[model samples]
Target: MATFTEHYDLIKPGTDDYYDVADFNENMDAIDTQLYQAEQDMAGVSEKIGNPGDEGEDTLFGLLNPGNQPEEKADFYRYSKTEIKKQIQNWKPNLSGSTTFYGKITTFRAEKNGTVYVKWTSSDTANGEFYIYHKAPLSILEAPDQSELGSSIPKGLQQEDFCYYHINYVYSSNKGKPTTFEWVFPVIAGIDYTFMWYASSASSLYLNEFSLGYTDTKEA
Candidate 1:
């Protein structure tokens, strides 16, 4: 008979280690049993340690600011329609898409800290949007009469000189009804800021409501 390899032996016609078919089948069965036991042990260990897949998911608070500070939440303060329209002489859409227009008007509110928000019930405004401008509180006080000129700048949240921001784009057709928008500008502590809004497009829109608020960052 031919001699087989020393390290591993398998049944072959001419090999010295030739074995019966029954014996080969028994060896395979034993190997399978051992493998199954090892798999179970590995699962038990994983269960004790807990799954390591979801390390950073499902969290409420996050470290957003520098020096490991937690992100802040905004505290909302509402404004009345009377107070918002006071800054604007005529709150109608100056730019008209068509000769005839329907829907309510657009209105907004400003905060001392330069935060502004606007709400509307429909998208009748030409572009279904508006512009926000800020003027220094002192400037608004001196030129109370200047409020008639819608182009005149209002108190800015960051810098001076006729700075303005835009919100909402003209939608080809109406999306959903009843929506509110918000914007934030860097503002000084004691210095008050005035916010103004004007129609971006000719579409007529109605101003439903608005608000101003502050945000506080906290550690969780």
Candidate 2:
């Protein structure tokens, strides 16, 4: 059968042409050779540390190591600044349909459709429930065009080229009652989002930790 690459080829190769799609698994030795070559060709760097002699602290490179930072970044959301951290915390949003007396709300992310759904499981049904009102951007319906975007976009966020979203959340417990609360937020355009929730015992609800993320549709 013709392979996926063959189907995608702009100009079909003549039957005589040779093609190899080993998937890098047919020969373990060849795979090992490639790995060795990469290790040999990669670069090495030596840098200074913040507190060089003190074993208590970490080096600059150590801080920048893989998995150490967020995949989606913003000049406005840098962890290095107290103000930035505060801003991100402030921007945290929530979308759960329920609330709690402790003032914490659940969060849900539904990718395909504009509707957001949540599954709440709690032993306390009455006091454990919360109410949520969804708030989202207008374009959660607007498709962001990746083809027209410039290079200024971040790595993970480019997927949102066509996705948009809004946010809303609340958490007000019912006092000693435990129950699951599920709410669906109305959405149009899909988007990358950061959701935050706080416990709302009274009419005023405070913000707590947030969920930050991004999502995109398949390229056309």
Candidate 3:
């Protein structure tokens, strides 16, 4: 008689029993089947766990390191240095204009929170007052009277009329020289702004340049 192993049911010939070819072949076939199935399973797993430097949707590496994703698509991934720099560089004002006391006044609506840069030069006889208003002063098209410059609020307009206001006085000594002055102010998005120069005598200021730039991200 021949006994069998408990787990695999492999035949174990007794010392006194006759040799049996069929039992020997059965054990070999069982071993072969188990090994074939193991090889197939390992092959499927290898496809998912790809080698280094591999990239695509199927591999684990691809899922973890997607490159250069746009703002809308970026969710859990940390932003790269290049991506951060691009965002900061792109934040700039879309509108700009320049005018002198004699030129037409320009008004612009800010597209985003930004800074307004007003650069101008005083004329040869430059002596009077200059003002920057967050909103266009619709009440008066021309500059306010010279006497109003000394008042807390310009004579014609009230304080609430212009939420943001700046005043600068030009002295007669600045006359005939290229006196450059710049006023920088943080402006809110979607608001109209304008600047004007009022000299006791006319044509004393020249608005050489007017521009806008983005404010710092942390401040915004």
Report, for all candidates in order, the number of backbone clashes: 19, 43, 1
TM-score of each: 0.36, 0.21, 0.38
Residue lDDT tens for model 2, 177-214: 33333333443444333232223233222232222222
Question: Which regions of candidate 3 are displaced past 4 Å?
Answer: 1-104, 137-163, 201-205, 212-220
Q: Among these predicted structures, which one has the highest lDDT?
A: 3
Q: Which stretches of candidate 1 lie over 4 Å from their true place?
A: 1-123, 128-130, 136-160, 168-176, 217-220
Quantify all predictions' global Cα lDDT against the true fold: 0.40, 0.32, 0.49
lDDT tens string, model 1, 1-220?
A: 5343443443234555555787667556666787898999988766555542323323212222122332232222122212232322223434333433322222223334443333334434344544444444454435432133242233332363544555554455354344444444444455434444444334445444543344321111
Which candidate number has the best TM-score? 3
**Candidate 3 CA-lDDT value:** 0.49
TM-score of model number 2: 0.21
